[model samples]
Target: MSATHALRSRLRALALTAGLIAAGAAAAQTGSGYFRYGDARLSLAHAIAVIEEPSDQADERRTLVFLSAQPLDAAAVAAAFDAMDAVREQAPAGGYVRLCIAADGSECGLFYSPEGFNSGGYGDLALQRNEAARIAGRWQLAEGDFLGTPYDFDLRFDTPIAPAPGSALPAGGGAPGAAYNAWLEALAKGDVAALRRMGGEDARGRFPEDDAGTVKESLKSLRDGEPLQARIARGRQHGDQAVLWVEGVDRDDIRRRGRVLMRRTAAGWQHAESDLSSVDE
Candidate 1:
């Protein structure tokens, strides 16, 4: 064959290969490696985003990648991330937020960050993601993690949390909210009788005479120093139970500590589980 002819044939082959490669790239970006678990789908980029960790190399910085269950454009993902960024802006600085869309319309995921060294602090990511999945309604996603791994949480909408009405008794106070406020006030004042009274029958049973010594010791220790000066930041109610989300300045000068008191049908607005316990002190 002529040398010129041979050169022309090589050029043609190169062009064809280049076209194929371009098409493959587009396909991969669209939906090449998205993982599907029933109606829920996680994209390859998103999976990588969630599992990615900090690297020794300085240039190994992490970036947010928003993936949809179905095909989405860069613009669509960017818009979602923008909304998440807004939420992040509203959140206190030095924290992480996880963004993921759950099967339900409600948002699901983690939104917390430790003080330093990738600490796993408030709003435990794993637990939040699991709980978000359980609730009904669609869940929107959010970003929530530093180094973003060790917990691959997805974003979900904030479920309206309210306190159960008539649940808390008026012990030297008014309504449930008022009583809770009074309880905290009494607790701050070291008013044991008032605190005990607010405890109602259930709290009393839990703090009976047999266990009074230990209970008193514990309660006294907690009530000793200005009662932590807590304020109700928010409240959420679910049937007979409710959660009084509080922010308190601890004696240790931790500034504001996120605390939660779970109130159930225990004769009054009695203390239940505490979310603060989930964090590292």
Candidate 2:
């Protein structure tokens, strides 16, 4: 070959070698790149895109099913977990497959974690009779790839409630102690007027206007019962608003613990909201 032709050939060879080296390096960094199952090959990003987020954050209990035509890889499994912001725990050795609701209300896609079960049993993603077979129809499972078909799942929601913040009868303040306490006292007294005075003009609109009448009916039933006392616990505070763990007990020994959210208003204080809790119930 002529000298010029030899140099051109050498340059082409050099370019090919560089391209191969670059491709090899790229593959190592991303761990096998796009996974190939059978007919379908998907990148990690694409695989994760298959799952969709649920509608309500309050709907914490959710289960998802994935029917895999074949075994899955670590990366594929990790991708599935990321879709739900969940973790996985190893199935306990020789233990009964524990199937239970997850704390975050999500089942683990693979392994169980402190939060929930990872895999196996009805608790994990349940498979349809032929779901995996259906997926295998479109694409066979391969060593490097994963395929999942749709399946049904449900969540057992443990009811939840927010804790109240704490507040005290500010320093020497009395009669109108803590905002929450004042509301409790007014409630105990069947004192609508007192509630309105402390709650401001908005009081009537705020409380069940007609419900104020019911307090007397309730009091009449308990006339022979003990007087009510307000106790606060697990107190937490935020700015002018304070939440209190409140409880009431009567002569009959009936007890109930609740959360009361109170805010400091110009009139003194007012109750913002309340709910029953098991802490002292």
Candidate 3:
């Protein structure tokens, strides 16, 4: 064979291979539910977004999470780590696609990508169906400068909405609420031992002899010289985890509100953490 002819044949073979690779990629992108970030993409298989009824007419936000077991790239793992570090919350193992939507379905506040977390106002969101039993939504960001990279994001999800776990109950009534009330009592009485017990194995040696005093001082600084006096106003328990909302009056008689997270161990419900803020009267 002539040298020129052989070289031309080799080029044709390489072109054929490139075309085949492109075709395969195009096939991967065709699906019912998918998340695409830059050059990588994932097929979302499941979704969960529960909308809880607001208590006391407060603003409520709902989270819609779409998960895909299909592997994307190494960047997905890095993105999960970034989310955990940025929010101090645990991220799911597989491809994690999340959106924080307002209760009225007016807007989406957050969007997750392989690059990292993106705050509100970067994309166009559309909700095709938003209901208690199911939800369908799409988020698209135009191809442009995003997070110092020339990339874009697109996610389309359609999946059933699972019911939010647990039942809501009045203060100090249900089991979880009662447990929260007990925790408040222990904290007010400066009972470190009881606090440790309520904290479960994770809190076995966490509290020191001066821990109660330290906590009180911290509360005093936030509560205007008053020790924390709170009562669980509502609660819900789902399996081993529970959330209890508390309402209280501070030293200045100002209203305060917070939530307590609890985990049920063999010994019973154990305190996980609490977050409190002053409520406008």
Error of 1 at 241 (Å): 2.0
Q: What is the lDDT of residue 97 in candidate 1?
A: 30
Global lDDT of each candidate: 0.40, 0.39, 0.58
Between which residue pairs do clashes occur in model 3? none
Cα deviation of 80, candidate 2, in Å: 30
Error of 1 at 95 (Å): 29
Which one wins on TM-score? 3
Candidate 1: where is the Cα deviation over 4 Å?
1-176, 200-202, 210-212, 224-227, 251-254, 262-266, 277-281
Error of 1 at 119 (Å): 12
Better of 1 and 2 by lDDT: 1
RMSD of 3: 12.8
Over 80-131, each residue of candidate 1 has an lDDT whose tens digit, in order, gives: 2133443344443333333343333222332333222222332322213223
Models, CA RMSD each:
19.0, 17.2, 12.8
TM-score (C-alpha) between model 2 and the true structure: 0.35
lDDT of 3 by residue, 119-208 (tens): 577778888877756677787776646566554566676655545545666557477666666766676665767877786665544565
Decide which is better by lDDT, 1 or 3.
Answer: 3
Model 2 worst lDDT run, 10 consecutive residues? 132-141
